[model samples]
Target: MKKDIEIPKVEDISVAVVKEWNDEKTEEVFNVYLINLQNKQIQNTLVTSKGYGENQSTGEKINTSVLRHFIGDLDAKDFAKIEPIIEEVFGLNNEYWVSFFQNNQMYDKKFIFLPETICDENMINVPLLNKKGVVI
Candidate 1:
């Protein structure tokens, strides 16, 4: 006899730029990660920049384009329940700094927000990054 199993409802989700490192002098990139508080899962994505040049004298340069969108969804009550956990995971306060990008341009891209239908399945290489915030 098989016993019925109950699945826990997902409470909250969040995305944050975890770290940025210099891959090459002309090519720096960022590592972004998504977190599911209810499930304690993480997904990491890499992003890069366009032009390559250094500033005179100061010797600093812009290595990457801004990441416009990072978004997620969860049950309202769940969000409240895990708000502290989400903040700790992302190391963010009420106002966090994020790179901004333009919308609808060739550079514009969108992140994926797992729909209710597939929230229970693993989403790999889902093209979950874009100019706008996460897309459901």
Candidate 2:
């Protein structure tokens, strides 16, 4: 009989450049933050835009948007705690996605639990799977 395996919660956070036009004329910037649900601590990350486009008004200039990526580990409980805050900050229609790891590969799947509740330090070095089965 297959036993029910419990999956720990985890969240991966990232910030992408949403807009970029005419590098010389205007530059877009993105600020990414990671909030600790338990303590409400926040970490700020900044990303500059980069892209290639023509600035017709300026005659000659390149337009670009630079995307920045940030990944944070949070357990299920903690994630739930701050889900509302995250949603409010990022809002709807943003480019945000979650992934799961299996056999050394990341799979696109929404985790059911908050990432802050999981114990990251203990599982950092451990492989996603082992001889028995998947490790949460």
Candidate 3:
């Protein structure tokens, strides 16, 4: 019975972590965004993000507070800013669990940025955001 459920695959959706200059703050900052690349809209979008990992030097396990964002809807080829991320958590494993509706069906996926994966070396010109960052 458990295997009878239809779980449609999630495609054309992405989560990007962007590093950009915040003119008002006079410093660079990290921000998260939810991108919809499907031919249709994404409705009732919800994203939950958190960071967790062990400190390399201190050997202490670290876990950041989990934050939930309700983005509502994202039009085709459009995107929505999810949250602002602090650079301090870059050393941890950052994860974003995303769920939404498309074509009246529910789909979800989990994206993880491994430790130190958000560095400048891995940055790319992210779509829609027009800034350099990592996307997973």
Maximum-TM-score candidate: 3
Which stretches of model 1 miss by more than 4 angstroms?
1-3, 15-26, 36-136
In model 3, residue pairs whose N, Cα or C atoms come closer than 3 Å (at least 3 residues apart or on different chains), thus clashing, are none
Q: Candidate 3, residues 52-82: lDDT per residue as tens digits?
A: 9999999999999999999998999998999
Cα deviation of 95, candidate 3, in Å: 0.7
Give the lDDT of residue 115 in candidate 3: 93
**Stretch of 10 with least lDDT, candidate 2:** 126-135
Which is better, 2 or 3, measured by TM-score?
3
Rank by TM-score, descending?
A: 3, 2, 1
Q: Indicate which candidate wins on lDDT.
A: 3
Task: Return the TM-score for each candidate structure.
Answer: 0.20, 0.21, 0.94
User: Model 1 over residues 3-71: C-alpha lDDT tens digits?
Assistant: 575433222444433222345656423344443343432222222212224545676753334332334
**lDDT tens string, model 2, 91-113?**
22222234434334443422121
